[model samples]
Target: MASVHWAIQPVLALFVASSVLLTGAVERSPPSFVVDLDKPAYERWNSVIDANPDLGRDAPEIFKILTGNINMSNDTWGILFLMAEKIHKRLPAPFKEELQGMADRAKMPISLITLINLAYDLTAHCTSVVSTDANGTIWHGRNLDYNATTYLEKYTVHVDFKRGGKVAYSGVTFAGFAGMLTAIKPHAFTFSSNERDVGSFLENLLEMMDPNSKFLMVLIREVLEEAKNFREAISKFSLARMPAAIYVILGGLSNNEGVVLTRNRTHVIHEFAINMQSDRWYVLQTNHDPWLGDPWYDNRREAGETAMNRTGRNNITVDSLYDVLSVPKTRNKYTVYSTVMSASHPEAIRTWIRNSTELIPPPPVRASASNVVGRFGTFAAVLIVLSRNL
Candidate 1:
């Protein structure tokens, strides 16, 4: 009986050891997708570009500059996939483990994971334009007229939160233009008068964010409440010197509604007509990515036309050039005008103007001198005139 128990004990010990080994060997689930950036895809892309020499030959200098700066590695794609995974909130466990492993290996602050993710995403999208030439030379579209000096001066702060502490990374280059500039000049555009003005504006704007900054808040509130009044003041001051139409244009009056009170009210008609010629005048947001066709473009045009027609200036013919300012900086924070024209046959300015339903009331009819005299006073004067004629 003792020998049999001893034999069973050895078997139990072996079973326990085997269980531990199996547990240790078990692999965590793979990330929804593993970005193997170290693979041959990078080389394939380069090879394709090297085989096509005629494609970017016209812009040799630009191509050289662009290719020199770009990092076309598997790491770039991996980072992009990670960002997309996070944004979609569908990151796989294995991917998460890899990210954790990377952070641990680098001894980086955990909070910085998100910032790194953002950097990766931005870089990936921006560098997508970079391609290789037939001779195996990499080219970047952004290198054309690349001003390295101007690129390095702008900086933005990034904050990361991990493990209940904040990690700050300053002077990080998330954009290619910025990276080029950083490599060139660390502090070239600082201390200028223009910089000072911009700094002051930013300071004031920042102060308004603090609840304790009562004075700043009051000033902001006043400015907001008096915006229309301020516009009117500027308009009146400028109108005193320049022609009414010019003043209206300079004083932030481009639409028919703004010019209705001015002497050259007809100017709005011309401006509207001119704006219609440019394909850019109409745009709208969409649920699908902008790379996909935007369904809202036509809808936005119809809406803008509807709004313009409501202003009641449809009939006026304008010969003079109308001042059509681009969408104001105050309105669009991310206004991007694409270099490529999307539509084949953009709507004509005249057609849009003709479609406007807004009608400016015709000028008041004038009464004849004889009719005025007969209707009102001056009967004695009329008789005197008749007697003198006789």
Candidate 2:
């Protein structure tokens, strides 16, 4: 009996291997065509950010707040921590240690400090405006309206900053001009949809500052470059003739544990589309990770989870920008350097698209015999009248 069992086990193993090989052969057919363009645009943009220290100079302030700078409010601390956590690894060790020191002085763990720092950065840098309605609900400049209970859902991009002689927190409303424009218009601008206009506005405002400071120009150029790459990638990858739009959300994560958790941060591209379909918007989402080979994604997830357990909510979601832009099932088959999405948040986008009126009428069919005969009689009468007049 033992001998028979061993013999059968080997046979079963062989059967399983054969089955796998057969499945692989069936699915291994080459694609009819391939898009093999090397995406150096995104790479260049990332390199610019990596090499520029001034671009992220304000990051440490947020980091200091995250490391338990009780002087700062929770909202301020939260936003900064999130930004720090996202971009921590991309920073040099000296910069990282400086931030860590700030966190240590505030008596917060590095992870918590970083998470809050990230949240702050997202709120401050990405957010365009924040307004409060009669209901006390906060709206981000991007047009996302959220009840006070769900602050995070209120904006596509969140940024907390000092304003109006006080530390003010604001978000880009996901329901306003930014969101609406992004939903309907083709994403062709460089930097951001609002970058050109925003840059202009900033220039006007910066006129009041000391012109000798090259900071403003440097910052504007950096922003413009980032936005340009984003627009170029979207234009290149978006499905042709489709009423779809795409957005590129760039952020970073740490990888202290030393494992690459995400590939090009493109994992979320398909998930974004699936979510849009689920929401009824047929948009595409694209994500690009300059640190694709880096171990930041895994480190960030693990660290975020750990910090989230300690803090009330893990600000990070399971469906990251990367997850929404890239399809996981076909990761090995196709590598997407950029992901496209119909909408940033599919559920809401579907509602908007479906609710909107149709632009064109359906095609008209050819007239049947009886209808054609009636039309012909009318045409004959008109022709006879015209002929008599001639």
Candidate 3:
């Protein structure tokens, strides 16, 4: 049996590599593509799935492996399974049907699809800066850091919702996932999330089961669709009981106002004003909660504060935002993409995606069969998307 498995593994590796190469995704830099969410949700997802057929199978498996690496137990998986089932029943029909379409097209279980979208407890570290220049142009910059091992090809360019009467907005996200981790509604506001805490497993499960429970992304979507200005946006956010712990930052061009809101499963813990006073023209958030006491937190917090201060409001620009976001001390090696949003003109969004070659770690000097197996795993994660101008 061991001999059979070893022989088949090499063949499977060759097949996957060939598949990726044939798609023409391997030869060029990875590209981003935009989706018009105004179209039926299912139709939009199906189109992307059709374009990258292998991703349908790859995504769920990636999540499964990730869950295991994180020491999540079978009992925890069971809880997530139940939560995914309940969350499906609670989602709006359009989004629910979208997951079903993706599952059918990808030939994967609907529960797995739901689990990938709903599970927000990741060891991702991100830094979001909401700032307004002297000219009143509000800018939101974010660096989304995560394990690049399996997430390289899952990246989606942007999701646009113009005709749905749903806050004409757009931003980049993962393929097939319904949640919006980053978005900017043109002429309305721009917002992003940085994971702060996973919260208790029991609380998260309960939040998922409650019919009235609303995930953070769902609540943010509502704010985008309905809120007309900064005040209205915060009002809506203030009322929501998010399902996980996250530090959310929102910016509006109308008032040049930016807010940093922190929430757990039950209530809003802290909300701070950013880019409010003339002297304080920016805000920063990383993985750790600000109020917590720790030396590492102090160092990172001071570094971010110093970076913002050195740039000065008079000198800040979109390019400068990227430079600060890319600072080695601030971002982890897992950083996959960085984005800059101009809230005043939301149509102007810029992103820098990590190259596929960077996905694989350096090979050790003395190689073994285990190293080959590890390379195979990395190869599977390197599925490609055809380059498209965004």
* True lDDT of residue 271, candidate 1: 20
> Global lDDT for candidate 2?
0.25
The TM-score leader among the candidates is 3
Q: Model 2 misses residue 147 by how many Å? A: 12
lDDT of 2 at 84: 33
lDDT of each: 0.21, 0.25, 0.62
Tell me the deviation in Å of residue 268 in model 3: 2.0
Cα lDDT tens digits for candidate 1, 143-236: 0111111121111111111122321111112111111101000111100000001112112322222333322112221222233432442333
lDDT for position 151 in model 2? 21
How many residue pairs clash in all the candidates, one count each? 10, 69, 0
Deviation in Å, model 1, residue 10 alpha carbon: 84
lDDT of 3 by residue, 128-181 (tens): 888878787788888776653335435544666656455377776776666677
lDDT of 1 at 28: 17
What's each prediction's TM-score?
A: 0.16, 0.20, 0.76
If both were scored by TM-score, which would come out higher, candidate 1 or candidate 2? 2
Candidate 1 deviant stretches above 4 angstroms: 1-90, 123-390
